[model samples]
Target: MMRPRRLPPCLAAAILTATAVAVLLLSASSPGGALLASRQSPPPPARPEWGPGRPPSFAYWISGTRNDSRRALRLLRAVYHPRNRYLLHLDAAADAAEREAMAEAVRGEPAWREFRNVDVVGEAYAVDRTGSSALAAALHGAAVLLKVGAHWDWLVTLSAADYPLVTQDDLLYAFSSVPRDLNFIDHTSDLGWKEHERFEKLIVDPSLYMDRNTEPFPGTGTRPMPDAFKIFTGSPWVILSRNFTEHCVYGLDNLPRKLLMYFANTAYSVEAYFQTLICNSSDFRNTTVNGDLRYFVWDDPPGLDPLVLNESHFQNMVNSSTAFARRFEEDAPVLKKIDDELLNGSSVQLVPGIWCSNLSKEQGRMDVESCLKWGDINTVRPGHSGEKLWRYISTISQTRGCS
Candidate 1:
């Protein structure tokens, strides 16, 4: 092989300086990296436009498993917005090819590429929704979102079975007037049957320690209910505030950690982890809104999951006034109905918003283009759905208090 040529002393110095600056910028861009750099460097500049009177952005963690990539993509498109950030995760149950395909799909969208607001979890972990591994996966997602350093006010978690009932514009407009610190979580202090089935019995999730997906098995011993903190349970889906998420992820208090340990051996910890944390904490208890902002219909004697939404549920779903509804079958007709009536677009097309209108006008096209014109992302225009949501929230807030 031929010897490589050496650069001149001046050129080498310039190259080194450029590389150092690039490294600094990369480190400062991430939330976790910025926290480390703060001890040594000046603080990063703030985005004043994202302050008060602006439409707040949401960081969505949309997760799925094997054969759910297409459904996840549909959900992402339904909820997609230039202002919001999205993280799509495929658990270890999905093969590497599936994960790669999901990433490619996200990158294939011109608007997604333009905004650079979507990401895929490259490293997959086994997740059993019936066990604590699901809770771990959710916490991991929240941590990644925080590290990504997005300027978002809330963190919403969704699954492939979920679909948006309202457009992004409608959701943003309805939330604009809401308090930034409030967390929309459905919870009740009464454990009822879950007290014995979920909390008292001990179980071990193989997903936590195994390389392959496995079901949770019961352990020999049982544990008593803790008198130290009260337990609350509710829907696994949640819309959490930034402050509350930070508290769970990085709070100095020991309550979050203690609960994490307690729930590690519990079944379906996702339903109880955040609920117990918020209800037990003095600081965040007052911020609970007692609603998850999601619509779900369970059977008379509810089974493990909610009934899969179909066309028959369309009218009731529309009247629910919730931003999202869950447990939709793949390519269900109800999703198409919601897309046509509420979202103003097809399932494959993004829900049209002010940004789409701006892009259409700027490009001088009669219809919106696939490529977006990023307008004032901080602004929002509410529609009839927004009015309905505002009314629903107002009515609930007046009567519901944190238990």
Candidate 2:
């Protein structure tokens, strides 16, 4: 092809500068660009005044995948509290429309809108529950919560399949006396059969690279265990203190990053990453409480996932004294039972709490209208369930020592 005519040096410089300015303006107008600019701005405003003796707030990262939008919303409503922060994530399996719908639903809630405490992960990536991607997603959620919620004392990760056995009022009352630094994580140093099959075995998750979800496949060669830090594994579901979460996310020490790299190729790293990190770190080791504070019923020979909970499991779940439970079929009747007996409200309602009472009075609405009345959000009034939870936590804390 014939050579194109070249512009003069000064003219070309002017054209390039003009193009750069145009591109900058375009980016500054886009939503992603606006978000980037906002991050560079000052941190979110200081936390609202938590009155004396107020219960500590929790930052919840509720994640789900395809077809889990409604279920996740229900779970959010069940656990909703004006003081706590909520971050919802529907993974890559969920289409953009579903994610938007979730965001819209959250925005539609009067309390959620008024408090402005709930957020939806707008840009989501693939996550393989069986592989390191799950760990990555959890960390991402933690990081986001740390950024968005400056006042929350704890970080709790939940999936759509999980549901609360106790209301927010009951949970807050139960935890009101708890030390803010304690971590409720079910962990054990004993690897048992998992040492060979999980720790030593190598696997790669396709979801990390592929757009679609796929199971992780094992490699032919196995690797040796690490001597640097002992491996600890447990339930992936955990309630982590802000202090420990900050350690994992910010990595003041190299331990968290080092273990993260080591677990990238390991099977089900989500189960072990936080456990190992907390147990290995001197600052956080002593803070572990050795219980996830969640209840579940597993098969006689426990399978990969816990059994789906239903109406029959209601009594046992209630007696377990756990704040949360898992693996419930969507809209299971047991959830309704928990709502009626423990929550004192319907599933769609926002678990009546002190905040609910206050919000009702502020709006001049009837005291009984919509479960929102005026009471002190600072103080917690525990019920029989809260008493049970407190006793359970106290018993566990006394028996379990972090080594």
Candidate 3:
């Protein structure tokens, strides 16, 4: 008998890549898979309405480190809307129990359970937020969102320390008027001091190769900035257009992947990677809005991190007309105030919106509402806060072909 012909190496690799992407897109994440298997799975959610007539949906990537499960969950509740999709990732610092507990907590929520749009990443990995590891984690998240969330207009990334200043209704309503292809990222090509300190330095991120991430250290000498493409730096937080995120993850164009390799050894790569990538790509360059849509107050000359928000900042936070703010202590009194006043919610309840108003609507005896179904999920009822966000967004016009 003639020997069977072997498949070409390139063809085999392409097949494997296609298979992996399909698997990621089709399945619920690891722990969630187990949860689904343990009980009867909820029916797949109806496809969200897209286009100018309907409000845009978001894909949120919420990351936390160590014992931040509770805070991350709190953030999720504050930002929750049935219309949106969420992916939660707790780094290796968080124990497996914590990860499992978070997954369980998600399952406990009636709306989350009913809608089944939320998931916990089944695996654990270390990430130093200052290194290429963080950028990798972010790219990983965008890829997962692209695969799992069949359609969403934008990808919003937040940390455990970050909190929403406006409700999802407000967010969706504000974005409704904006172009679907626009990207909300703060970027400036004026590298200034960062040219030497961040871009020119050669650093090795242990997290890239090691099981647990260690501190990233610099080499003896620095290299010159690249002449191939200009570099832009800005806030690490961004609301990226789904189209741009697809470019980053799928590498349909080579620019995204090329920048990814160059930034792998640079410090605080997350701060510059997306900014650089978006500003460099001719296709996406004109789509920029030059703002992350988050509120933050740095120190006088600025420090490594933004100042921690407190009760003092509450009034200003409200007046800032921004959608989100950062660096809050876990369960701060300010948070409760935000819930009660701005969000029209409590710690126990999700921020009420078009999908569901009563997460715990129950009578004394047996007349309890089924959390599985609520009002029209396609519509939104925006409050005064929504108006402010829309106005703010309108002011930040599109980029003039990337500085």
Report clash pairs, candidate 3: none
Report the Cα lDDT for residue 66, model 2: 96
lDDT of 1 by residue, 1-403 (tens): 1111211112112122222211111111122211122222212222226778788889999999999999998898889887788878877789989877777777666666556577777666778989888887777677667666458899999999999888888898888877888889999988899999999999998888776678999998889999999999999999999999888777778787788788888999999999999988889888889899898989989998998889888889898889999888898887878877888777566777776654322235455434434444556777899989988876665543457
Top-scoring candidate (lDDT):
3
Candidate 1 lDDT at 148 equals: 63
| lDDT score, candidate 3 | 0.78
Q: TM-score: which candidate is best?
A: 3
Query: What does candidate 2's lDDT look like per residue over 99-159, in tens digits?
Result: 8777776655555654667777766577889987788778777766676668888899999
Give the higher-lDDT candidate: 1 or 2. Answer: 1
What candidate 1 gets wrong by more than 4 Å, as runs, is 1-48, 358-369, 399-401
Error of 1 at 279 (Å): 0.5
Give Cα-based local distance difference scores for all models: 0.76, 0.74, 0.78
